[model samples]
Structure formats: structure tokens, C-alpha cells
Target: MTDRHASAHWEGDGKTGKGTITTQSSVLDNNPYGFNTRFENEPGTNPEELIAAAHASCFTMALAFQLQEAGLKATALDTKSVVTLVKDGDGFKVTKSALTLTAKIPGIDQAKFDELTGNAKTGCPISKVLNAEITLQATLDQG
Candidate 1:
């Protein structure tokens, strides 16, 4: 079992507050975020975007391992995740995460590809931890 940590420092109110996020790996060293970045689509990072990146990376890695276990190798795998946040009863809530994958696996059949991708989509840790709906769209490239 492995444990990872990240921290955030926030100041002021929710509407006008600002914060900096830091990860244990220091990949995000005091990255800035705030209401403007999250809601106004400013130039900065946001939780939803971070979740999207995590989901994409986790799902892709899971798929790679699944393919390896099945004795298949991929030339390339590209994934994109979109996380949707919406207003719920009294506050904001993450409603769903959608994954889009385009893969180049030399000797994989459509049926096998579907099986592995489906398994990865459900088996990835991020997917398991998320309370929102998860959806995947996968494409196999033979050319």
C-alpha cells in the first residue's frame, strides 16, 4: 500500500479567496488557484481540472497494465478526461467524469480491446474513489 499527500492553503472568503496547492512530489509547487480560476475560467488551475488529469492518467496506466497482462502491447495510448461540476441543492457538486481514449495496439481485436478498456475504466483507483458517474469512449486504431 502506498500513501500520497497534497495540501492547499486558502485565504479570505470563498467568492474572492485565493489558494496555493502543493503535492508531496512537488510537481505542483504552490500552484495558485482561486474563484476566478475555478468559476471565471481564468488562467490558473482548478480542482476539476486536477481530477480530470488524475482520472486520465490513472485510467490509461490501468489499461496499459491490463494489456500487458493479456500479452498485448500498445504502440501508443492517449486519454482525455472531462469532469463536470454542477450546482446541487445548496452547493456545487461534481456530477460526472467522462474518459475519451484513442489507442494504437498492433495486434488487438475489437472485442479484446473493449474488454480490457472496460476493465480498466472500472478497476482504476481514481474511478473507484470517485462518487460521480463515470463514462468511457474508446477508439482502437489499426492503421
Candidate 2:
């Protein structure tokens, strides 16, 4: 098994507090995040966006490998994930994550590509990890 690590530090109170997030990969070292970035229209990053990125990357990778295993070579796979954060009880909660995928593969049938896309949507690590509802819309390139 493999492990990945990320940390965030917060000071002051909840709304007015500030924090920095760092990851084991160092790709997001010292990245700033806070209530303003989460609720308000301020600069910086938020948890939902991060989750979206993770989901998109994971699903796309899964599709790539699945295509290879099915005797198909994918020229491109572009995916976008939209994470919805909704009010639950008192605070907030993630209710759903929707994935949209656009793919290009040489000599691939739409039906086969769609089957693989569905498999990837359900089989991706991030998708499996998320308890919220997951949905996928796939578009296969004909040109």
C-alpha cells in the first residue's frame, strides 16, 4: 500500500483565521486557504476545488489504463469534475461530484469507449473514496 500526506495550519478563529496547506508531493507547498477562499469570492484555493482536481486526475488515469487493456490506444483524455458543497444540518457537506470526460482514440467504437468510461468512473480511486454521489458524462471523439 502507498500513502500520501497533506497538512494545513490555521490560526485565530474560524472565519477570520488564515492557514497554509502543504502536500507530500510539494506541488502545493505553502498554499493559502481560509474561509474567504471557501465562502467568499476571494483569491486562493478551497477544499472542493482540490477534490475536483483529484477526482478528475484519477478518473482520467483510470480511463487511460482501461483503454490500453482493451487493445485501444488513447490519444487524449480530458476530464472535468464538479464538486458540490451543500448545507447539511448545521455546517456544510459534499453532496455530489460530477465528471465530464472528452476522449480521443484512434479506431475506437463509441459503444466500447463508453463502457470503459463507465468502468473508470466507478473504478477510480478517488471516486471510490468519495462517499458522495458520483456521475459521469462521456463524449467520444469521432474525428
Candidate 3:
């Protein structure tokens, strides 16, 4: 099994608090995120956006491998994940994650493309980890 790590440090209360996030790869070294950034749409990264990024990247990679496994060569894959956070009781919870994708794979049928896309969406590690509702919308470019 492999392990990855990310950490956050905060100062003060929720609304006015400020924090920095750090990742194992140091890609997000001292990256700022807080209540304002999350709820107020301030100029900083938010947890939901991070989740979206993870979902998008993970789903795309899984689809690539699935395509290869099916003897299909991938010309391109463009994916987007949108995460929705909503109020739950006194706090908040992520309610949904929607993934949209467009792919270019030569000599592939819609049924097969859809089957692989569904497999990737269901098989992606991030998708498995998420507790929210996950949905996928896919387009296969035929040429």
C-alpha cells in the first residue's frame, strides 16, 4: 500500500481564520485556504476545488488505462469535475461531484466508449473515496 499526506494549519476562528496547506510533493507549499476562501469565494484555494482536481485527474488516468486495456489508442481526453458543497445541519458537507468528459479515440463505438467511461468513473480511486453523489457525462469523438 502507498501513503500520501497533506496538512493544514489554521489561526483564529472559522470566519476570520487563516490557514496554509502543504502537500507531500510540496506542490502546495503554504497554500492558503480558509472559511473566507471556501464560503466567500475569496482569492485562494478551497477544499472542494482540490477534490474536483483530484477527481478529474484520477478519472482521466483510469480511463486512459482502460482504453489501452481494450486495445484502443487514446488521442485525447478532456475532463472536468465540479464539486458541490451544501449546508448540512449546522455545518456543511460535500453533496455531489459531477464529472464531464470528452474523448478522442479512433475506431471506437459509442457503446464501448461508454462502457469504459463508466468503468473508469466507478473504478477511479478518488471516486471510490468520495462519499458524495458522483455522476458522469461523457462524449466520444467519432472519426
Candidate 4:
């Protein structure tokens, strides 16, 4: 099956501008930019949040695939990606992305898990796209 998704339009100057982000099922209305400073320093969806979401989702899926390839079933996979936008001389840039992951898998040893996680960190599409530093911390849950 082929699935497709889309988001609506955005315009304006960014810092003193305004726009809206719409998806297939949701619409972030009247998103503005000014004082709050994440998304244009006021109100709106910023790039960092988007990047975090993308990285988190991509990493989780990559880990799942890695586990399956290793003849193991992944019962649960949770990942959090923190994107840090820091001042780069004169402008702000995404300097790093820290990915924290917790997974539940039966019969997977620590060494194997660590190796798979490392491979997934490099194999994930988002991780491949960003030049920012990528760090991973993985916890394997045994029950």
C-alpha cells in the first residue's frame, strides 16, 4: 500500500511574520512568530521541534527493523530526540541531536543490542541527513 500525507502553506518574514501548518488530520491555526522564540521567537512551529519528531520516529523504526533482521522481535521501542540549536558565530544552527532509546526485546544480549543500536543510529534516514552531532543512549528492558 502506498500512503501519502501533506501539510499546508506558510509565509512571511519569520521573526515578525505569521503562518499556519496543516496536516491531513490537524491544522495548527494562526501560527505567528515573535516573542516566544522557538518558532520564529514568538508563536508557530519551529524547525527544531520538527527535526526532533522526525529523528525520534526514524530512529525508532530503524531499531525495530534492526531487531527483526537479527531474528528477534521488538516488543516495545521508545525514543526521544533532543535537537539543540545553538549560536554559531552569528546565526543559530542545530549543533547536535541526542537520541535516548528504551527497548524491550526477548533473548537479545547487551552486546548485540548495543551493536544494533549503533548501526540503527547511523542507518536512520534523518540521522544521515543532518550533519549535526548524533549521540545515542540505549536501555534494554528484560522482563
Most accurate candidate by TM-score: 1
Tens digits of per-residue lDDT for model 2 on 84-118?
Answer: 99999989999999999888899888889889998
Which scores greater on lDDT, model 1 or model 2?
A: 1
Which segments of candidate 4 are over 4 A away from where they belong?
1-12, 23-44
Q: Choose the strongest candidate by lDDT.
A: 1
lDDT of 3 by residue, 56-133 (tens): 999999999999999998899999999999989999999999999999999899999989999999999999999999
What are the TM-scores, per candidate, against the unseen true structure? 0.98, 0.97, 0.96, 0.81
Query: Which structure is stronger by TM-score: 2 or 3?
Result: 2
What RMSD does each model have against the real structure? 0.6, 0.8, 0.9, 3.2
Stretches of candidate 2 exceeding 4 Å from the true structure: none
**Residue-wise C-alpha lDDT for candidate 4, range 49-134, written one tens digit per residue:** 77899899999999889988999988889899999999889788999999999899999999999999999999998999998999
Candidate 2 local lDDT, residue 30: 86
The residue-by-residue lDDT of candidate 1 on 31-77, one tens digit each, is 99999999999988999999999999999999999999999999999
Clashes per prediction? 0, 0, 0, 6
> lDDT of candidate 1?
0.97
Q: Each candidate's lDDT (Cα)?
A: 0.97, 0.92, 0.95, 0.82
Extract clashing residue pairs from model 2: none
lDDT score for candidate 4 against the true structure: 0.82
What's the true lDDT of residue 100 in model 3?
96
